[model samples]
Target: MSNINPFDKCPVYETINLIFTKVKEEDAIDLFECYSDPITKSRMNNDNCGGVWDTHNIDAVTKGIKGWVQEYNDRFYIRWSINHKQINKIVGTIEIAPVPNTTRFWDGACQTGILRIDIISSLENKIVLSEILRMVSDNFYVDLDIKNIIIKATKDDGERVLALENNSFDKLENSTFPYSDYYIK
Candidate 1:
């Protein structure tokens, strides 16, 4: 495998209906729609991350996007804006980062990617999630040099749970995380 860092030049992932690319300042308006929506925030997995997805204004959204870019530069994580093809707008963001030792969630020999996906509640269905999950499953392992992918989905999130299951993600029954149930692929 190549030793180059994927964060050096964020790779864009595309599906038939959506595109995932590094979050940019220009995405503030569209992202604000998602960030400010209570429904979207309800489905987001903040977990150990200190930041909250809910925002009150575009300024906060803009600042958040800048922080995400800086985080990418620091190799802390890669946050991608999920753009819908038909709508021609950013529907949400997907954050993929290495499982930190602080979490103590995975004891596996190979590294694992912790995925946090937050999309507009209207599009937060099995079909849309399955497509996004498929893209992650197909590329994130080799791109991030990880053997597994893990995500959090609450029991109430029936669509997300079903999508994860359809994409070959099994629930981690003994997960120590209290925020929600975790699934591994």
Candidate 2:
């Protein structure tokens, strides 16, 4: 595995339909749309992360983006804006961080990465989610040096659950978090 610090120079990933890059101040408008939407706010996984997902204005979104940038500088976690290639707009943000040993996992102990994907409800279909998960599967394991990746998917999110299942992620039965089911790959 490479010992490179991903935070040193943030990595940019691109797939046929999406592009992932470090969140920027300019993304406030597009991101505000996601944050302010009721459906999108309902699907966001805000566990562990201190920030509130829902926002009422562009300033809140801009402040949030600044916080994300600060978090990146501190090497806490890297948040990437998920840009839809066809629309040339940011549809969501994905965060990947090394799972701290303090957090409980199904297995006793293992190297893991915790993934959080917050996207617009309109693009919450299996196809779109599958593509995003595929990009994570293809790159994050090696980049983060983790044996497994875990994500929280609520039972109500049928499309996201299907996408997780289709992308080699299994529902973890013994998750400590009660709000949502955790999936591991």
Best by TM-score: 1
Residue-wise lDDT of candidate 1 within 1-185, one digit each (tens)?
A: 33556666788889999999999999999999888888888777877778655488999899889998998887678899999999899999998877763432122343777898989999999999999999998888777777778899888999999999999999987665454589998
lDDT of 2 by residue, 1-185 (tens): 44665767788999999999999999989999888889998888877776665598899899889988997887667899999999999998999865773532222353787898989988989999999999999988767666888999888999999999999999887665444588999
- Cα error of candidate 2 at position 56, Å: 0.6
Model 1 residue 121 distance off true place after TM-score fit, in angstroms? 0.6
TM-score, one value per model:
0.91, 0.90
Residue 83's lDDT within candidate 1 is 98
Which runs of model 2 end up more than 4 angstroms from their true locations?
101-110, 175-180
Pairs of residues clashing in candidate 2 = none
lDDT of each: 0.84, 0.84
What does candidate 2 score on TM?
0.90
